[model samples]
Target chain A: MNITVLLKQVPDTTAKITISGGKVDENSVSKWSMSPYDEYALESGLQLKEKTGGNLVAITCGPERTKKMLTDAAAVGADTLVHISNDGVTDSTHVQKLLAAAVRRFDSQIVLCGKQAADTNSGSTGPGVAELIDAACVTLVTEVNYSEGKFSTIRPSNSGTEKVAVDGLSVFAFDKGTHELRRPNVRGIMMAKKKQVESITSGDLGVVLDSSNVTLNSQNPPPEKPAGQKFEGAEHVNEVVSKLRNEANVI
Target chain B: MAYEALDFYDVDSLLTEEERMVRDMVRDWVDEEVIPNIEIACREGVFPDEWRVALGEMGVLGAPLKGYDCPGLSYTAYGVICRELERGDSGLRSFASVQGSLAMYPIWDFGSEEQKNHYLPKMASGEWIGCFGLTEPDYGSNPGDMITKAEDMGDHYLLNGAKMWITNGSIAELAVVWAKLDGVIRGFIVEKNDPGFSAPEMKGKHSLKASVTSELVFQDCKIPKDRMLPGVKGLRGPFSCLNNARYGISWGALGSAQACFDSAKDYAMSRIQFDHPIASYQLVQNKLSWMLREITKGQLLAYHLGQKKDSGDWIPEHISLAKMNNVDIALEIARVARDIHGANGILDEYPIMRHMANLESVKTYEGTHDIHNLIIGRHITGIQAFTREA
Candidate 1:
């Protein structure tokens, strides 16, 4: 059973968001790091690989800058690295197709990815890839147990948690798990420096490139909240009540 | 949130990705592990014993040494580790420096094959802690004139010496004791439990309080003849080890300065005065700008020196210059930071005072700032100043 983990390199969460020429200026980012949720996914994939004995392949679809993320994944004990070059594609659906192709190319029995990427919080990639590859998909998965060719997944549901046992191929989009990602020690980093990342164009995956249907007119920063008005003394209580009932419309 | 190292001049661009990764990993560990416990440990004046194994598992112990289960990292990476560790606290950085450069380095450079094979792996794994014994009670800067001696018996060597201000001495499993053998300095490995050997922990240290400072005492200690480091003799062996440590201190001081800078900058921005944050004041900006400028210069010095060390182009004078300048600047930055925090800086809640106090020791140790100046002065003028007649 080979496992594939989807990795995304996002700007540091603390980076100040700045818009330039109707798009988010990536150059403004002070650092590039792995998406937070994807860390959980990678941890889950690593655990699964350790238990079931399989090739752990970390796959990412991005431009050259994302190679650092793959190197990082390798440093944390990922056996193989795959980079799908989709430099121009920004569509969630198109990126999912490329990721699915790489997963299939690796002959993966299990696939794992973040519930959503930090840059684009559209929780669609895992399910979209699952649909494309015809594998059972479980979103918001926290843990997965594998035993004797069967896989059982635990995930949060509306009322309680659900433990779904699925046979054959499956995709687990991970939320926060019991285990966080492990830091790569010095020896691991030194060893990871030698691991080569297999870079492939969409052409190699036999996936034709197409323009994204979604067009960004402009990017804008979130509006700052107004300062809170404080009411003092017993005399202003009525005024505060009236404002809450009528002007604020909370009542 | 991800750690943003103070790279005002885009220094990260100059570093390799691996170096940056190493810095981030160590920085993260420090933030998670060391930062939380440092204040309490400093207050208690006790070095945390648990960190040895954790640091070993992280491969930070003897990180630059090759093989023997060591990480064999680049000098730049080793410098990065020191920088990050010192950013948490100077004590942590001192522990690593003494372990890697002072203790393990001498063994790797001068020890016999058997000694290397026996000690390096154990030290690398943190299974056995090691300390360097060179600085004597009477001989601070002048180690070559030390009275400590090791006598050669037919079957074993009799060692008698007392080493002062030894880091990791009390808990170390082995001490790399440098003593005069027939008026020539040689390295010998003294086991902690050896007869007539005892390491007594020195108490009442205000500086480097989070580190274990002890005295290594040897009273006619018996050592196996094979325990001696066979490859090297004379003052050159110890000087080489000092150079390695001095190089690391050059980088480690930058970390202490950076932590103070960060704390001061944040505190200044949030601390309100006269209906505005004190950071809006010109005086505050002046201090902040000065600190940033010095720290940036220190970073460049350490970075270039790390490159030179990696390429085998660096000389002892280069190490002295960096060690002297960086520690001096870091001490200055800590003072400025202490002022920026007003009265709050003195409290343990803020790291400014702690760093300020720690930098004092840093400035004094690894060849005091004045000693480094003399070393560099000799390099430039081709004249020895220490022994010159007034």
Candidate 2:
């Protein structure tokens, strides 16, 4: 069983962002690393490939500079890499269509992706690709097991939890907080340089999806969260709970 | 300007991919195997004897020297391995340096082919541990005033002397004993099982508690004449080994300094005082900036010196300069880092105190800070200032 993990390179979460001149300042972003959620997807792919005798392919959709993430993934034991070099595409629907067209050329049996990209938080690609491929889709999946030509997925649901079994090939959008990512050893990173990385262009796929649906209105910094209120003594617990239920309205 | 341009020297790039891989492997091993047990080992004041064979299996015993079952890595990579191992504990790095630089180097560089073939492989595999016996009870900084002697016994040589502060002496299976044979200093490989040989542990050591230091006594010890090193015969033989160990000290000091700096930096950011993090204060920032500057400079110096050694252009005076600069800077960084931690720095919970204690030994061992300064002074002024008799 050949596994293909779709990884999206996002800015490091620990990076301190600065806003100046009505735009995000790139100078403040010091280092580039793999997105936290996508790291889980990469770990899952490596684990599955290690357990089953198969090849693990890492696919990314971004600009040319994003190849570093692919190279890092290869260092962590990804057998192959596919980079979809495109200029600009913010619409989730357009990205899904493009990736689906490109993935159709490969012999991918299990497709894995993060639930959302950290930059935009648009959790629509997994379901979109499942729709394009006409396969069963599982979102927010935390655990996955494949045996006897079937895929068993465990994921959280609105009503408690749920488990679903899908036949044949499938797509899974893994949620964060599933498991801690493993650090790659030096030997593994050295061997990764020799791994095969095949770069594919959207034009080569012979399909141009419609990207006219969405337009960028404005990009700005998110407002900082308010400092949390501290409570002291047993009497304040009742007040805090009341405020959380009535004033904050989160409970 | 530009946040004082804090330098995290890119010394790692000087190494080849394979060499860097060896460095990273040992770094991981030290972090996993050594760091976790360091506190316990230091508290017990006993070295982790189990890691000897394990470290040998990892190719650390004779990592840089080529041939005879050694790892054959570059000098830069060996420096990196030393730096990482010392980051966990200087005692651990001391074990590797003594085995690789002091003991194995002499046999490989000066020993007969038969001697090299006999001892190098066993020492490399950790099947036999080795120590270099050079520092005598009377000779610490000055090695020329030695009284240890070896008398010719036809087929065998009778050796009589006592060596002090010898690392790995108590546990070593073989010892590379340096003694004066007919007014000429030479190296002789003496097995521990040899008659009239004894290594007793030195007690009451406050620093480098996790390493074994012993007094090697050779009372009429008879060693085979063939074990005598033929290529080197003089003070230069042991001085060259001392140079090698000092080169490693240049890099090892940086590891301890970096660890202290990192701890202090983290503590300053999170530790609260005056209703705000200490990092917000200019005074704390000043201390941190100073440490960063020193660490950066020391790292760059060690890296370049390692490159020089790799290219076979390194001089003894150059090594003295590096050793002098890095060890002094490391001791200062440890002190400032401890001051930033305030009362907590005195405790072992923070590594500043431990590093502060260990740097004491690092400063004194191989060559003291004052000795190295004299070496640099001699190079500049064309006069040797270390000897008052002259």
Candidate 3:
């Protein structure tokens, strides 16, 4: 089986975000890392590939700096790396079409990606690529098992977890699964420095982008939280109760 | 809040992408693994036995050595590993230094191919713990006067000596024992179970509490002829190992200092006094300013030293200077940080006192501050200041 994992590079979760000129100022982001949820997706792919025995490829879309995430993915056991260089932003559908082309080129039997990118939290790429490629799509997957020719998966439903089986090629949008992401050993990091990433433009994948319909008006930082009121001494007990009951709305 | 390393001089720009990756990886690991348990380990006065395997799996045991299942990292990368580990606790960095630069480095540098192939792989994987035995019970600053003797008894060598203040001594599976044979210092690989060999753990320590310090005793210890490290002999063999370890200390001291600075700055910013935060006070700012200034200089010194070492332009004098200067500054920083924490610093809840205590041991070990100064003086004045008339 051929498995492909979709990865995205996002600003490190700890980096302080600042805005300039109606958009997030890229320069203000000091560090970048693999999107958190994508790590779970990659973990699921790696575990499945370990038992099923197949080629594993990690794919990402962005500029040159994003290649670091691909290297990070390779360190943890991605065999082939594909970089779709698209410095310009495209609509979600166009990006999905580009990813679908790469998935088809790799002849992937199963595709795995994060439920949502850490930065945008759009959660659309995995299902969108699946629709474009005409493959079965499963979201919020927590567990997966594979047999001779069938794939068994467990995903959360509106009420509870539901077990589903698929017979054909499929895409899985993973949630936090049973397995935590594995940290790459030093040897893997050293070897990853030598792993080559194949960088190509979206045009190389035979995909064209149309103008996006979405527009951003402005960006602003979240409002500062109000200072917490401190209640001290027994004399203020009734006042605290009144505030909790009336203003805070908690009894 | 996540931990951030001090890089005020844009030192990250000087490093390669791979180097940055190494720093960040080890930094994250230390934050997750070492920081949480360090205080408890210190309070219990024992090194976490489980860390050996974890460290080995991370490939930091013999990180800079090539082949033999080693990670083959650059000198800078190794230095960064030391820095990050020491940021969590100096004892942790001491563990890596002893295992890598002291114990494993000599074997890789001076042992036969068979010895290298046999021990380096196992040591790298943390399957077998190794410790270096050089500083004798009575001879520390002057190891040349060590009384340990290894007499050649035809097919085997009989070794008898005692090494004190040895890190990882009790838990080590193998020890790189240095003893004089025919008045010449030679290195030997002694197994833990060798006849008449013992490593007794030493209890009680106000400093480096999270590490296991012990005394290695060898009484009529018998070892096979082939166990000797044949590639080098004389004081050069052990001095080379010390150089490697001291070089690591230069970088590691900065880590401890940075930890102190980080804590001091954060504490001063939030610790309110009178009406404003303590950070607004001039006295507090003075201490923080001194720490940042000294740390920045020490970082530059360590970075340059690493580059020179990798490029083959460095000498022992450079290492001595760096070790002496960085450790001195680190100890001062710890003191300042402790003062800034006011009584809260003494508690294990804040890392200030632990770091302050650990830095004391660091300043004294790997050739004390005064000894290194003499080494530097000798390099400049063409006279060996460490020697005296007999």
Candidate 4:
């Protein structure tokens, strides 16, 4: 079995957000780091590789900077990297197509990705790739256990926790919780220096250029709320109720 | 302010992928594990003994050594590792430096195969903590003139020596003690449990407070004759260990400098004065620019030296140059950082004064800054300066 982990380079969440000309001014970002859920997904892929003897490769659709991100993945545990050279392709739909093509090229038995990217908050790529490649899809999966050619996945359900089983190959969209991200060991990091990362252009993946259907809209900062009047617990309950009905007009 | 490891000259690009990863990983580890606890540790004068397992798990102990389940990273990687560790606190870096370069290196470099097989693996896994015993009560720079002696008993060696300023001394399971054996300086692997051996904590030290420093006393300490390191004789054994340690300090000092510079820079930029950020002041910019300039030079020196170490063409004097230069700049940068913070720099809330005080020890240990200049001087002059006074 061959496992593949998908990673994305997202701006550090703690960065102060600013808008310029209807889009985020990326220059305001202090740092770029691995998305939190993708890190969990990578951990899942590593675990899958460890349990089932096979190479775990990481492939990402990112720009030149993501090369380091892929190498970093290798440093943590990935065996190899295949980068779908990012040429400013922001369309999530196109990214899914490219990922599906690369998954086919590697003949991966299992492909794992985060349920949602932190930057875009667009959660379509996981199931989109699964649909494109005709593989079993598990979304919002929190835990996965592989035993005897079967995957036992655990995810949250309205009733409680839910367990689902999938046979053989599948695409997993992870939603954090449970997995502990392993730090890079010295030996793996050293080997990462020698690990070859195969690069493929979008054209080689047969991804056709098309005008993105989405139109740019003006970006604005969220509206600031008026300062709320503080009540002195039970003593001000009557006043609070009157304010909510008269001033807030919520009654 | 967000502290990114200063790669002022795009130095990370020059580093190998593995090296960069190793550096960044250690940095992340320190930030997550050490930063929150370090201030209290320093204030209380307690070492974070709790982190020993993580440090060992991280392969920080003897990280450059191969085998014994060690990480065996490059020297430059090790340098950057020290840089990252010291950025949190120099005492933390000293703990690692003394563990790897001082304690483990002597065993790996000089111990017999049996000793190596026994100790190296355990040390790598943090199952055992070790400290080096070289600087004695009467000896700091001049170890050759020391009086600590190991007598050759029929069944074992009766080692009678006292070592001072030893890191991890009180907590170590083993001590790589350097003592005179029959008028010849020899290194001994002294276990802390040996009879008549004691490591007493030296208290009230204001500098390097985040580490354990003690005096190792041996009142006829007995150990198996086989425990003596068989590889080298005389001061060369301990001097070589010191040389290895100095290499770490070279980068460790730069880490201290980077921390101070980060605090200083961030404070200047955000701190309002005269209705404008102090960073807009010409004097503040001058200080920061100087720090940037010196730190870049130090980075280049450490990087190139690491490359030389990896290529197997390294010399000790180059390490001396780096240690001396980096420490000097770091202490200066810390003072300027204090100036930038005005009054808050002195508080435990910031790391400037802590690093400043710790650099005083770093500059002195692993060969003093002046001693390094003399070491470089000796290399250039081809003449022994110590004998000129004689």
The most accurate candidate by TM-score is 3
DockQ, candidate 3, comes to 0.59
| Cα error, candidate 3, residue A58 (Å) | 1.1
Candidate order by DockQ, decreasing, is 3, 1, 4, 2
Give the runs in model 4 whose Cα sits over 4 Å from its true position. Answer: A14-30, A88-90, A167-169, A206-211, A216-251, B312-314, B377-388
What is the overall TM-score of model 3 with all chains considered together? Answer: 0.95
lDDT of each model, Cα atoms only?
Answer: 0.90, 0.82, 0.89, 0.87
Local distance difference test, candidate 2: 0.82
- Tell me the deviation in Å of residue B325 in model 1: 0.5
For candidate 1, lDDT tens digit of each residue in A89-144? 76878898899899989999999999998887889989999999999999898998
- DockQ of all candidates, in order? 0.56, 0.13, 0.59, 0.46
Instruction: Order the candidates by TM-score, highest first.
Output: 3, 1, 4, 2
lDDT of 3 by residue, B244-351 (tens): 899999999999999999998899999999999999999999999999999999999999999998898989999999999999999999999999989988888888
Worst 10 residues of 3 chain A by lDDT: A86-95
Which residue pairs does candidate 1 place in steric collision? none
lDDT per residue, candidate 4, A29-62, as tens digits?
7677888889999998888888888988798988
DockQ of 2: 0.13
Compose the digit string of candidate 1's lDDT tens values, residues B1-390. Answer: 445678899876788878887887888889888998999999898889888878888888887789878888889888989999999899999999999999999999999888999999989988889999999999999999998899999899999879999999998999999999999999999999999999999999888999999999999999999988998999898899899999999999999999999999999999999999999999999999999999999999999999999999988999999999999999999999999999999999989889989999999998998999999889999888987564
Q: lDDT per residue, candidate 2, A1-251, as tens digits?
A: 77888888776665666767776666676545577677777788788788786988788888776786787787678888888876556677767877787667677888889888887788887899889988788888887777888888888888977888989768999887366676554335556656656787778777575547687566688888889989989979889999999989999
